[model samples]
Structure formats: structure tokens, C-alpha cells
Target: MFIDRAVIEVRSGKGGDGAIAFRREKYVDKGGPSGGNGGRGASIYFRANSCINTLFNFRHGITIIGKDGEKGGTKLKYGKYAEDVYVDVPVGTVIYEEKDHKFIGDLNEDGKIVKVVKGGRGGKGNACFKSSTNRVPRIAENGEPGETKRIILELKLLADVGLVGFPSVGKSTLLSVVSAARPEIADYPFTTLIPNLGVVSSKGGESFVMADLPGLIKGAHLGKGLGLTFLRHIERCRLIVHVIDMGFSGRDPYQDYLDINNELKQYGFGLSDRKQILVASKMDEEGAEERLSEFKSKVNEEIIPISALTDDGIDLLIYKCVELLKTLPFFPLYDSEEEILDHKVYTLEDEEPEFYIKRPESHLFVITGDKIEKYYKMTNISTDEGMMKLITHLRKIGVDDELARMGAKDGDLVQLCDFEFEYFE
Candidate 1:
């Protein structure tokens, strides 16, 4: 299976917590806080691999998690940071944040590494809190949490020219004759389920890649056929080769050409504006010559007449394609970073209050703030020193003053996050 798109969840490791300890020795007279700090968390990264051509490797819902950092030890010994994790993807893979549709990075070159998530920072140890006035401080902080994200990965095939036309238009046959790619060929429509890429070298020894895209019908832009599924592969092509079957069908070659162009125009993304070469296939058929003449009269541009079975006019077509490739500029798959920044747009949302104080019931006060909630989650309230640190932080941030202004009395019940305590004046 040639998979091109996938969705996966990734998470970075959290930092280790700080340790609190006191030095004990036989001859040492003065021993203060000796706790060591925790180590930092691991980070997640994505690397490009040219050997892999499809996204099928990530078919399953894989959750990538980084290794956690080692914990701190006694004697003020800091913990070791964890190693970062790297996931390899195929070249030309583009990643986007699933929720907000934000563009993360594009992996266009092999061995390119992009940091997807950053690890959390480690907390400070009790030794860091020691002061002259305090003398024997016993406070230690917890490490911060790592980042988590869900992203979408899309792969676009890298090719120089793309062959697009209705079904059974000698696209696969032409690819087989030009390069080593042997796509499935049949008389029925939609024979080529997936895009087939081939390398063609001109007589001058210049080589370029060509892609045999799936067939496009009248409503292909609206996703009526395989065109909608494989149209993305055409975005990277520098030129388009429209192969028209001039024999064996009741459909007019001229109308068929117009419908395909209409679909390309509707698909947008500069596909219709791309340079195109018209090739009328099966010229050896009985009515092919007459149809080719009619098509030529209708369209003023040069249309190459070819019979893939007999290998006639294939050389001239390849030569023309190569000549065009020399002058055409390479099209980048993504927009410039400056272009993205210049078109800035803001998302409006209801502004949240800095802090909220509410009384769920009589004498039961609830305090909540984004910052305070995060602090509460990281605080270790099992020890008396931990509780004191939390109280001091709240007071420093004016939370206590805000509570007093809200008619909070002495010994009143106060709740923050999941922890509850008695309020004091």
C-alpha cells in the first residue's frame, strides 16, 4: 500500500523532581540543605529518510514518547538529562498541527531534522533556596511538564513532469517504454490506482522524473474519481503532459481535452496555469489520423501524434519535454516564510479573566487562575515546607489580597485545584 497521509500523537518527556536532603557527618560542624535538583525531560524530533517512499510505515496509530530524565541524588548532585528521540519519515513530508492547522515544517531533503516538541525544564533543589536569614531552607521545586501534540503528515511525490489524462490513454504504456516503472495497464478506466513515477533521460544525457497520475473524469474536481485522491502529486511537477486517446472510444478527443483542463482549473493551485504538452496517442488506428487532424484544427498549439505500441513520435515528445525543462524554473512546494508572516490573521475568542474567585456553596470559596493551577499541579504539599512555599507564592502573586477583598474571613474554607485549606487573615 502506497500511503501518503497519516495522523499520529507525540509527547515529550517531563523533567525529574528536585531532591531535599541534609548533610550528616561525624566531624562536620555546619551542615545545611544538600538536596540536588532534577534532570530535564526528553524532546521529540522528525528526520527525513530518502530510502522510504511511502507513509505506510506509520499506518498504525503510533504514540511516540521520550524517555524521562534521571532523578536527582543527595549531596547536591544534579540529575542527567534524557536523550532526545528522532522519528524518520520519507522525504517531501509536510507536517501540520491537526487542531489549528498550523504549518510546522517541511522535510524536503534527506537527513533533515525538525524539532517537533520540546522537553520540560527541571526544578530547583533545596540547596538553591538557602539564604543568610533563612539559614536552613527546606524548599524544593517539581519539574515542569513536557509538551504534547497531535499532528498530520502528508507526503507529496517529487517529480519533474506529470502525465494526466482520462483512463487508458497510453500513460502507463508510455511510462513503461520510457523508464523502468511498469504500472498496471488495462483497458478499463482507473487502471492506474496510484501514481507511477519514472526517470527519462534525453538524448543529451539530461534526466528528469515523470509521474503517471490517475485518470480524471468530468466531476474529478468534486472527487468523483481517482483524480481527487492523487491530484496532490501533481503539485510538484514542473510540466504537464496531457495524453489523449485518439482511437476506440465514442468520446470526442477535443471535448475530453476541454473537460480535463476544466477539472485542472477547478482544482486550482496553479495546475491549469502550468505548461502543458498535448500528445495524441494510438495514431496507427483507422480513425486516429482524422481525429488528430480535427483536434489540431480546434487547438492552435502543437500536438504530437504518437503510437506507443509502435514507438513512433516518442523521441520527439521526450526531446520537447526536456527542452522545456531547461527553461522552466523550479516550483517550490511551500510558500515563503515571509509570505506567511505578512498575511497575519487573528483568531477572536472570549477573553478569560486573570483570576476568578467563586463561592460554590456557603463558606466554601474556590480560587482559580491559569498560572496558579499550574503551580498547584507541580507543588508537593505533603511536607510543611511545601505548604509554606505554596502560601508564599500565592501571597506574592496577590491571590491572598484578592481573597481578603472578596470577603474571605479568618479560618474560612478555601479550595485551589484539588487541595483545600483554611484561609487566615
Candidate 2:
């Protein structure tokens, strides 16, 4: 079960609400607000694990949620913060945060980790609203909400050189002889379903990775045989080793070479900027030399002929590849992803907190405002003492003054978000 891509939901924990309480000691001269603030929420993180190669585990679990923060308590005791959740993925994974189509972190290097979702901030307690004018304040804030997002994770195999040619052209055969990788090989087309990686080393201890990707057909780019699957795997390659079958047995060998290169060019990096080597396979066939000679004149590119079956010209191919790799610049194969540096921050002048709640919605006072919501989260509403602390806290915050300015009379019906009460001091 070699999974290459996966989509999952990630959520950070919400912050805990603040506690609203007053100092009610027997000998205290005057008891003031003494509520504690709520705890911070847990954040969601993505870690890169070199041991993992596939996204098979993610398939089973689509949603990953973090633990919520503990609520604040009385006696000015702050709530406990929750631990963050870490989701481990294999290296070379690229993630795209779907909301804004923004590219996230590229987990190319081993042990690279990234924080995906941010946790909500904890609310303030009533004690924070204390002031000289008002001794008793009655307002506690609720905890902030954590961030949630859905993203796509794709795996790009790291390979130094990629083998490109038509199906059943002996790309896998050449790989078997040169490296320890034993890919499924047969005489039929599309025999190798998955891309196979092999390590080729020289006598001087020079080594490079090779990928025997699925074959490319004439319409591969347009959703033909192996189609986009083959093209995507080779995107990271520093070089394209074009394997041409001069002794096609029936099909036009030259035409086959043209079609494959056309597909590569059409798919664009246009990878034409990268290094390429032309190699004629199945050289043991009769008249292969004749066709090879004619093919060179038509194509006029550097061609290395080889018989992968008997290991003929295999060494030369390796030598040529090692030589080419030496001169080429080292480019990361996980080039599909670009590092993202900034996050989207929304800001609007005079933007009011506006949200609607239906009536008969469980005594819900539809309140509006960022400051108010944050205050509520920071408030601890568990105890009556805490509630008093909340009210006194709110009063000190000039909520009472604001309400008076809004034209409130004695015994007037007052409305606040999530809670409603009769107005009278």
C-alpha cells in the first residue's frame, strides 16, 4: 500500500474560559475582583518522520483534532493549557492549504516540521477590568476559538535521474542490471505500474538515484496511458535519460522518440533547461545499428546505444550518467513546493462583530464585538461568585457607561451577546 497523496482535516484546540471571582476573605478590608484568565488552546503541528515513506496511515484517519484547554477556576487560579497534537508525515511531502490555494511547507529535508493550525487565545478574567473609577467590575471573557483547515498532502519521490521512454522499452530491465531494485518486468506494455528507484554507484564511490517511472504514450499528457501519473514523478529529476528502442520490432522507433520528447516539452518546466541523454536500447536486434545510424542523422543529438539484456554498454551508460551528473548543478527534486513565508491576515476598519442567533436559541444573547467575545472567553461562569466577578469586571470596562450612553433607563430591558438582564444599578 504505497499511497502518494492524501487530504485531511486539521484543527487546533480552543482556549479555556477565564474565572470570575472576588476575594472574600473574613479579614479582608474590601473584596475586589480576583478572577483568573482562561488557559490557552492546543495547536496543531505536522512533523516529518524519515521512517515513514507512504501516507497509508493518513488514509485511515482523515480528521485530526487537538485537545481543548481546561477552564479557569476560582481563587485566581488560571486554567491549565492543553498539549498540542503532532501529525507525523514522511519527508518529501508537499502540503497545500486549500482555503486560499496557498502553498504550505515543503517537507523535503529529514526531520523538518511545520505548524499548520494556530490555537485560539485565552480570554481575560474580571480582575483585568479593574479600574480606579469602578471598584467592582462584572465582565469575564470567553476563550478564543482555534483555527481549522483542510489541506492536501502530496508525496514526491526524490530521484537524481529519471528514465523516460515508451512502455515495455526495457527501462525497468536496465534498472535491474545497474541497481539492486527489482521492478516488475514483462514483455507487455504498462507492466511496471509504480515508479521504481535504484541507486547507481561508480568505482570512485560516486552514487546517484534513478527512477524507472511508468511509460509515456503519445497522448500521455492528454490523459492517455499512465498519463499525468508518469509526468509528475519525473518533475524533480535533474536529468531525463531518453530510452529509445531502435529495434521496435514493428513500430517506428524514431517516431517513438519524437513523441516522448514532445510530451516532455509539452509538459514544460519546460524541462528542456535540464540535461538530457539519448540512449538506444535493445541493440542486439538485427539492423539496430542501421536504424541507430539513421536515427542519429535525423535527431542529431548525442546517442548512447546499449543492450540491457546482456549488460552490453551498461557500464558506458553508467559512466556517461555519472559524468553528466558531475557537471550538472544540484537541484532539489522536491521542487514542486515553494516555501511560504507569510500568512493571510484580515483587517477592516470599523468592522463590527456581527453574527445572528435565532430566538428560542436557549436564552442566547446575540452579542457582537471582538473585545466582548474575548472578554467572555476569559471569564469563568462556573460559580455565582465568579458571575459577580464577571459583572463587576464588565462594569469597570465601561460596559455600564456604554449602555447608559446607548439610552438605558431604570428597569429597562438590556441586551448583551449570549446573556440578557434587567437594567438597574
- Which candidate should be chosen as best, given lDDT against the real structure? 1
Candidate 2 lDDT: 0.79
Point to the candidate with the largest TM-score.
1
Please list the Cα RMSD from the true structure of every candidate, rounded to 1 decimal place. 4.1, 6.0
In candidate 1, which residue pairs clash? Answer: none
In candidate 1, what are the lDDT values of residues 1-425, reduced to their tens digit? 77789999999988887878788877999888888988999999999999888888777968899977766678999988999999999989999999998888888889998888988777777888888887677777787778899999999888889999988888888998888898998889889888988999888899999999998899988889875777778888899999999987778999999999999888877788889999999898889999998998899999999998899998999999999988887666543333534244665654454467888866789989876786875666776888898988888878788888888888889999889989898
**RMSD of model 2 against the true structure:** 6.0
Off by over 4 Å in 2: 97-102, 249-254, 326-425
Candidate 2 per-residue lDDT, tens place, 1-425, comes to 66888888989988887666788999998899887888888898888889988898777549888877877777778888989888889987888887776677877778888898988777767787788976776667778888788998889877889999999888999899899999999989999899999999876688999999999999888879989887988887878898998775577888998898789877764465678888899999888999899888888788888998777888888998999888886455333344333566566964654322222333322345666665554555665645776678678766666656655556665455566676675
> Least accurate stretch of 10 residues (summed lDDT) in model 2?
355-364
